[model samples]
Target: MGDGATTTEAGPESAGVGAGLTRAHWWILLAAALGWMFDAMDQRLFILARSPAIRDLAAGADPSALPALAGWATALFIAGWATGGLVFGLIGDRYGRVRTMALTILMYSVFTGLSGLARSWPEFAAYRFLCGMGIGGEYAAGVALVAEAMPARFRPIALGMVQAASSIGAMLGSALSLLVGPQSRVGGWEGWRILFFFGVIPSVLLVLLRFRVPEPDRWLRARDEARRDPKPGRELGDVRAIFADPVLRRRSLIGMTLGMVGQIGLWSIGLYTPELVRDVVFREHRRELAVEADSLDDLARAWATETGGDADSKLSEWKAEADRHVGRGTLLQDVGSLLGAPFCTWIAIRFGRRKAFATAYAMSMASVWLVFGGMSRGVDALWMLPLLGFCTCGIFGVIVVYLPELYPTRLRTTGMGFCYNMARYLTAAAPVLLGRLAAGAGGYSRAAIIMSFIYVLGLAVVPFAHETRGEPLPD
Candidate 1:
C-alpha cells in the first residue's frame, strides 16, 4: 500500500511569517472562498425563492397546504444533503480532494441550474433535493481541499476565510432576490423561475476550476499503491478506520453531537426566521383588518341610517389596507437578511468561534422570546428578529474552520462529513416539533426558551473541546 505521505515543496513555512501572507497561500484561500461563496448562494437561493413560488403555486388552494409543502421540501432537501456528504466524503478520502471538489461544484451547479426549469412544486422540490446533494458534498471537499493545500500553520485561517465566504454568497442571494424579484416579468411563479435560471452562472465556474485547481499532493502520496495497483477501483474503508481507533471514536462522537446541536439551531430555528416574521406580519395584518372592519361597519351603519352608502365597498378598502401592511412586512424581512449576514460574518472572525457561536444562539433565543412575548404586549420588537439572524449566521464561519481542525488529513473529510451533515436529521425534525409546541402553547416563546437551553448545553460542550486558536493542524 502506498503510504499517505506525498511530499510537496510548499510546506508550512510557505504560509508566510507573522507579518504577511504568501502568494500561493493567497491563491488557495481565494479559490476555496470563491467556491464556498457560490455553494452558500445556491443553497440559500432556494429558501429565498420559496415564499413567492409557494404563494403562486398555492394560489386558490388551501392555505394550510403551502406550509406543509414547504416543510416537506425542506426535509427532502436535507436528506439529499446528508446523503451527498456521506457518499462524497468517502470519495474524497479515497481519491483526491481537488478532484472531489471539482466534481462536487459541477454536480451542484448543474442541478441548481436545472432547478430553474421546474414547472411544478414537486419538480422544483426534486431539483432542490438533487441540488442539495451536490451542495452538501461541497463543504467537506472544499474544506479538506483548502486545509490540505495550505501550510499547516495557516489551516484555521484558510478554513475560516472559506467559511466567511458563505456570508458573501448568502448576502448575494438576498440581493439577487430583492433586485430581480419585483422586476421580474414572469410575475408570481415565473419570477421565481427566473431566479432559479440565474443559478446557471455558477456552472461556468466548473470550467475555470478544471484548469486552476490541482489535487493535493498529500492525498496522492497517501494513496496505497499496493491497493491501487491490484484494484484501482477499490474504495478505502474510512468509516471503519474512524471507529476502529479509540481516540477517533471519541472525537467522532463529540463532533457529531456538536454538529447535531449546531444544525438543529441553524436549520430549524435560524432558517425559519423569515417564516416567523411572516407569521408575525400576518397576525398584525389580521389585527389591523379587524380594527378597520369594525370602523367600516360602524361607518356603514351610520351611512345606512343617514346617507345610505354601500357597506361592501368600505369592507374592500379595509382589506386592501391590510394587504399593504402584509406586503410591507414581507419586504422588510427579505431586506433585513442581507444586512444581517455581513455583521454575522464579521462577528465570527472578530470574537472567536466559540464565543461567536454561543453569542449567536443566545441572541436567537432572546429574539424568539421577544417575538413571542413582546407581540402579546403590543411591543414592536421586530428588529430583534433580524438581529437573531445576524448572530446565528455567524456560526457557519466558525464551523468551517473548527470542524477541519478536529481531524487529521487521513479522515478529515470523512469525519467532517459525518459530523456536519448527519446532524441535519435532528435539524430536519426540529421545526415540526417547534411548530407543535407553538400550537400547544399558543405561542413560540416556550419553544424559544427550550432552544435557549440547548445553547447553554453547547456552552458546556465548548469548554471540553481543545482550543485550536493559532495552533497547527494536528499531525
Candidate 2:
C-alpha cells in the first residue's frame, strides 16, 4: 500500500478548511466543476450525435448496417478514453493536477470541432477517440482536485455537486439537439456536424483556469515530501507500486470491479436510450405520427429549417417529428440523471456508501429491465426512461466520492484513474457486444435486458467493497 498523507498536504495547515470551503475554495470548485461540466457536455454531444453522424458520414451504407457501424465508433471512443485516463493519471500525480486538466480540456475541445468535419466513418471515429482521451483524463484530475481541496466533512457533498453538474451539461446537449439538431443532410449541412462544432466552445475554459484554479495543496506537499525522503519503491505516480503493494492491490481490484459494473451497465444499456427510443419505442408510430402533422410543433418545424430551404417537404416534417420524440425521451432520462447523482451522494451521507450502492444497483436492475422489456411507445418512455436513468447512472456520484477515498495522497490520481479507466478498457467492447446480441436476439431491447444483469454483479461485489463514508480521503 501507499504511505500516509504527507503532513504538509493533509495536515490541518491546508487552508480553506476554516470556512467550510471559503470564497477562494468555492472558486476552485466552480472552476473544476465547470471543466467537468463542459467535458460532460462534450460526451453527451457525442452520444446524441453518434447515429446521425454515422448516417451522414456513411452516405451509401445500408440502413440495417448503420447501428453496427455506430457501435464500432463507440467502441473506439471508449478505448481511447481508457488509454488517455491511464496515461494522464500518471502525469497528474507526477507533474501536477492543474496542468493535466488544462491540457485535457484543450485536447478534447479541438478534437470535438474536428469531429464535425470528418468525411468518413473511420475519420469520425478517430476524432472521437482523440476527444475521448482528453475527457477520460479530466475525470481523475477534477475529482482528485476537488477531493483534496475541500475539507473532509464537505468533500463528499462538493464532489456530489460536481457530478450533478454534469447532468446539466447532458441536459444542455439534449435540449440543444431538439432546438437545433437537423434531421437530414440538406444542402450539405448535416445536423450532427453542427452540434460537434459547438463543442469547441468549451475551449474558452482554459482562460478561466489560467487565472483562477490552482493545484491542490495536498498534491503539492506529497511531491515535496517524496523529494525530501525519497523512498526507492514508492515514487509518486508509480504504476508498479499500485499493484506491488498488497493492500493497495486489493483496493485496486475491488475498485475496478465496481467501476466495471457501472461502466458496462451504463455504456451497454443506459447510454443507448436514444437508440432504444428510436428503434423500439418510436418504431410503430410512423402512420399515427403522419396523421398528426397538422398538430406538429413550431419548435419541430424550426428544427427542420436545417433542410437548406426545403423545410416544407413531407419528408422533412416526418424526420423532424421523429427526432423530436427522441429528444424529449433523452431529455427526461437526463433530468433523472441530474437528480439521481445527488440522491446517491445523499444516501451515502446518511446511510453509508455500501447501502447506497446496494440500493442503486438493485433499482438499476429493476428499472432497466422493466423499461426495456415493457416499454413500446413514446408515452411509456416518459415515465420509464427517467426511472431507468435514476437507478442506472446515479452511482457515478458514489464512484466519484468513494474511489478517491480509497488511496493515499501519493497514489490517489493514479489509482482512481486506473480503477476507473481500467474498467473502461473492458467496457470498450460493450457497444460491439450489444450490437452482436441485438443482431442475434431480435433487437436492442432484448440485448439490453441481457446486459442489465451486469448490475446484479454489482450486488455481489458490494460486500467486498470498503466503506469510506465520513472518512477523510486517505492520505
Pick the lDDT winner: 2
TM-score of each: 0.78, 0.90
lDDT of each: 0.62, 0.81
Position 203, candidate 2: lDDT: 84
Poorest 10 consecutive residues of model 1 by lDDT? Answer: 1-10
Which candidate leads in TM-score? 2
Candidate 2 C-alpha lDDT tens digits along 364-428: 89888898998787666778888887888788978888999899888888999999889999998
- After superposing candidate 1, which stretches have Cα over 4 Å from the reference? 1-22, 58-61, 182-189, 224-237, 291-360, 371-382, 435-452
lDDT of 2: 0.81
